[model samples]
Target: MTGDHYFSAQPSTAIQRRDVEFTVAGRDYELTAAGGVFSASRLDPGTAVLLRKADLPPAGAAGPFLDLGCGYGPIACVLAAVAPRATVYAVDVNARARELAAENAARVGAGDRVRVVAPDEVPDEVSFAQLWSNPPIRIGKDELHVMLQRWLPRLAPDGVAWLVVAKHLGGDSLQRWLGDEGWRVERHASQKGYRVFRVTR
Candidate 1:
């Protein structure tokens, strides 16, 4: 198996640590990344696009938000920093990614607000007020759709989700699919060949 695939639940490669720094919504972040994680060397372009394009949570926004497929906790940390009253859940399948995300959260002093966990570890009763993701599109269309189906429903009735996908990676098709699935999907932004989608129930 390739060591570069972020969707590997247990990456079969040695962890070689590095630093990844980026700015989102005027806030700066320097997080730890490793060989086995997603965007192990830098802030992924899709993630940067998503952060820049989506409507971030208001400072007064409260309660839980979800960073689905959180790699090293970029989105989760941003949400926690922006919405101090909220709790951010950083969910990932890769163990190495989860570890790095937790460490990054602590580094940002949002450790108290960022909860890094495996997908199934999230409490069944907890529903999210907002969801953010730069999904693992390489997992193939079927698996990607399954992942979205599993979590998108957990959004509260008034909640919204922000997603970024590369235009060549079926971004438009995904938007249509979400609409067909009964979501109110909006093409919020298109930048650098990436499509940012805003989805609501």
Candidate 2:
């Protein structure tokens, strides 16, 4: 196995691409996945739980949504599919992942609406109405905290962020940390050893 993690900005390993299929809210999705990206083989169970438990935005929900740490655009595609009016931003540090995300977005006929980009590429002035993520928890606590600190502030006053974390991977502690950091964190759901959090200011 390669030493590279999905979070690597420029994965130095060979790229082996494939399709990952899953259904959310009775809607089917088959997104492109590849080596060096998060959950390349299947829809991650945590992500499945997140999509299943967290309240999805209404069909008429406005634009400017975020899919933080988008792995080949599954979440972004689903968001765009469900909320046709929303402009979904799919952000990832991995270049290969970003490329596949863009392609997957196009395949889903959401190319015009979903913006696949690196984290730094997102405009500083833009705030999101909703943020969804299956965070990169294995990146280490310090880095994970920094990542949250950086993005959570970009939520609009009434915006909400949904996150799925493995229970054994400090999910409870992370919720506590977010609470200590002054955001209201609710355990929206727990299933298959994962904790889904609904966060808001």
Candidate 3:
């Protein structure tokens, strides 16, 4: 991976930690971000839309959940906060991102329940009840598809994945591809030029 890419295993960008504040499901979050992570300047708009539009697991929900490509663990933290019984896995390629995610999860009091790790650290035997992502579309189509292929099959038989992609960035095409791959894909919501897909096996 490119040294500057947020998908890089170890980002070379200068570390500059800062706080990004946002609200999801009426709860507030102030996550720590650094130079090499995704959306370090603010709560990414696509993620904002996903959390707003998608159905978060209820307070009583139990899960082995996933926040794929978790940058600084915003989604993972939120999932853990909302579903106290859930174990939320925050997976990322960037080591810096993983570190920040761990710190952020602890800040949100979800550290014990949120596992922040490298993508390869996830066990193959583990299956997810739900998955969420504001995918790194800029990573290029083939890489993005490969990433999805690696993770989507880990979903439990009845599990669902929530994804947010910019409309200009092949959201519809991705929906078609998922359908072609035999998954049921629903365009759950559209806002701020982003498309939210709810996918199931």
What TM-score fits each model? 0.97, 0.97, 0.97
- Write model 2 residue lDDT over 71-166, tens digit each, in one string: 898899999999999999999999999999999999989999999999999999999999999999998999999999999999999999999999
CA displacement after TM-score superposition, residue 27 of candidate 1 (Å): 1.7
Task: Judge candidate 2 against the unseen true structure and give its global Cα lDDT, from 0 to 1.
Answer: 0.94
Candidate 3 lDDT tens digits, 1-201 = 336988888888999989999988889999999998898989899999999999999899888999999998889999999999999999999999999999999999988999998888998799999999999999899989999998999999999999999999999999998898888999999999999999999
List, residue by residue over 107-188, the lDDT tens digit for candidate 1: 9888988999999999999999999999999999999999999999999989999999999999999999999999999999
lDDT values, one for every candidate:
0.92, 0.94, 0.93
Question: lDDT score, residue 58, model 3?
Answer: 88
Q: Which stretches of candidate 3 lie over 4 Å from their true place?
A: 1-3
Candidate numbers, best lDDT first, in rank order: 2, 3, 1
Root-mean-square deviation per candidate: 1.1, 1.2, 1.2
RMSD of 2: 1.2
Give per-residue lDDT, candidate 3, residue 109: 91
